[model samples]
Target chain A: MRYSGFQVIKEALTGHKGWKPVWRDPEPQSHYDIIIIGGGGHGLATAYYLAKEFGEKKIAVLEKGWIGGGNVGRNTTIIRSNYLLDGNEPFYEMSLKLWEGLEQDFNYNAMVSQRGILNLIHSDAQRDAFTRRGNAMMLNGADAEMLSTEQILDRYPFLNVNDARFPIKGGLAQHRGGTVRHDAVAWGYARGADMRGVDIIQNCEVTGFRLENGKCLGVETSRGFIGANKVGCAVAGSSSRLMSKADMQLPMESHVLQAFVSEGLKPVIPGVITFGAGHFYCSQSDKGGLVFGGDLDGYNSYAQRGNMPVVEDVCESGMALMPMLGRARLLRMWGGIMDMSMDGSPIIDKTHIDGLYFNGGWCYGGFKATPASGFCFAHLLSRDAPHPNATEFRFDRFSRGLMIDEKGMGNQPNLH
Target chain B: MIINHPLLGPRDAAEFTYLGDASLINRPDWQSETAAQDFYEYGYLRSNPAGIHRELWFHEAGDRSWLVVTRNTVTHEISNVEMARDVARTQGRSK
Candidate 1:
């Protein structure tokens, strides 16, 4: 049902029995025209756009677990388009635009809050780098404002300005960048796709792919063998393992990136604030909890839990940025496997195996790229070509020496 | 998590930088005819096993030495840790 204020008021006036489940739980069928593995935000969004925009039918999204159980739900929920690389800035800008209209387009309340994001600058070198990044962002059609320390202090007074080690000199602010309710995105896309006749089969783990004679046919799942003419793998951190079934090794590794939310407190942080001297970013959730995260656990693992040193280091950075956070009690923390690529970018291209398409290596930035990743991936699957904005994200970029090294980390997945 | 360093006793795992598959130390000959393909394979591909794995860890903050760590990815348990220089020397790696 289309969610609206009228429906809510009508249901409130009535017995509130008019509401239905957000999406249906449908069983699988024998065959489908297209099958999308991993029903996270990307997979569900691909199915949604394929049906809603591309007019493709007979689509099925097979999820090993329930929806919103992966990195889609385990992120800090920040969204921004402030990228430096030409190959990445435009695509992320497209995603930011899509996020601007997501709640209305899907008729779901995703809580897309555009409060703004401030990447705090601490030194002269960082200021120059941020200035270049801001120019790049503005050139790519995304809003970016260079705010002085006074302007940042005017907005966020809680930031530690007296710190001598890493003083906040300035900040690169994106007024359009902010956070959203992470799980609601997965739910909205899943509901949208289910309404458009896309069968979303949960608990259907793909055991192997049906590869014969260098051509793909279908997948062997825990439920049974399901046949599909075309198959797209949007599995985020599990890309290496999932593609290994088809005997394809990806140019990526999985590392655990953890996120944390503090106990409920009064509204403090007006928007997302990232520490420049270290890897820590935080924002106040609508529920009054401080949501934040930092670097990965620096290891190759598929496990969903992280170690403690990263947590200590993250809190150290937070306390360094805002000394008052030392008083706030830690509520809880969780980890999600990030598919870190060599250049810290993503890969959305067709594989040598016919009828198989792969989309992964999103690292910690996957949550923000949900809309555009899906739209571009759907474009690729439907038209057999990459979208104009996403043409740089190819599997051959590394081999051809066209790698989009965003962090300039040079083939280091963890560093990125 | 604490990784028992071979020379430095117990140290936090956060001080170490992870590089997957200890086999990367055995770099292919740069002058070989298939050097491009070999480097491509060396740069990208991985076994990425779910169980025990032999990996490389750099002590970036402490000794500035690389360590060969055999750890279990599933259980987050370290089975063995050795100096990567020693491991490379044993493998007859020069320069």
Candidate 2:
């Protein structure tokens, strides 16, 4: 059912009974042309692009639990293309563009708000680095503006302008960078894929890959054995665990990252703001709650909960940046497992096994890279070639010492 | 989270630095035939299990001793704590 303002008004007048389910809850089929593992944002988007754009048939997206129960729903929802490296800027810029027209394309109200994102500059060294980063962003055709301290103060009056240790010097603002309604992204893509005859099978966990010689035949799932000509694994934090069944250990670790939200209040934060001295990044959600998060718990764990040390550190950083947050009552917090890659970048490439592709190692930034990750993974799965934008995200890059080390952190998954 | 140090009874987790899986201590020979592949696998791949995980933690703020802690990843429950030097020696490693 196509939705529009007219349909909304009509449904409102008719007691809202004409609305339909966003996506079908389908049973797993015995065979499919392509099978996608993990029904998160990337997996659903891959299936959506495969069916709607690539015109692929007999596609199935297998989920262990419900869709959007993974990192897609457990994020701060900020999206931006303000990156320094050439290996990352273009891909993320493409994702930002996709987010721009996503609602209209998927026919879902995803609430893509390009309110802007500001990365505050503290020290002179940080200003220099942010200047280089802004230039790099502009070189990649992404919007970037270096804002003065006065301009930043004019925008965010609640910030600490002259703290004893770290003073806000300037900022790098991307006018197109902002947050999206994260859950709507999953629903929209799932609906789009399902409308295109793609089967979205929930409660179907892939136990092992059906490997024959060098090629993958299908997958062994909780439901049963399902045959597929090609299998794409887009599982995020569980990449290593899942690939271990195939005797392939991934170059990533599962680390839990926590996020928090404050009780609903009047809208004060106009855009996403990130601290320069610390890891605190925050934005006001549409529901008026202040959503924020900080660094990882700094350990390897699959547990979707974090300890108090990191939580205390995050709140400390928040207080350092904005003292007004000290009074806001904390509503709740949650954690999501991140596939922290060795170089702090993602890996979207085919594995040593033929007909078996892998898409993961997104770390904590997977939420922002959802669209491009899916589109590029779909391009790779369909054509058996890396997308031009994702040419550097190969699994063999680590062995060849050709890593896209965005943060210059070497081989430390948790740090990434 | 608190790590029960072998020397010190219990230490706050904030005082220690994490170095990930204990398998990292098994450093392969540099002059081996498949040194490149071995180093690649050694430096990159990991058995990031969801259950009991044996990992290394350095007491940076205390005795500066490297310790191996066997803990459950799911429940964050610590079961065993031993000096990494002893664990490495038992696994046939010496300076």
Tell me the tens digit of each residue's lDDT in model 1 across B12-95: 887877877898998999999999989988987677766788899889988989999998877888999999999999889945
| Model 2, span A251-306: residue lDDT tens | 99999999999999899999999998989999999999999999999988888999
lDDT values, one for every candidate:
0.92, 0.93
lDDT of 1 at A201: 92
Error of 1 at B82 (Å): 3.4
Model 1 spans > 4 angstroms off: B6-10, B60-64
A311-407, model 1: which lDDT tens digit per residue?
9999999999998898899999998999989889999999999999999999899999999999999999999999999999999998888999988
How close is chain B to the truth by TM-score, in each candidate?
0.93, 0.96
- Candidate number 1, chain A TM-score: 0.99
Clashes of each: 0, 0
lDDT (Cα) of model 2: 0.93
Q: Work out the TM-score per prediction.
A: 0.97, 0.99
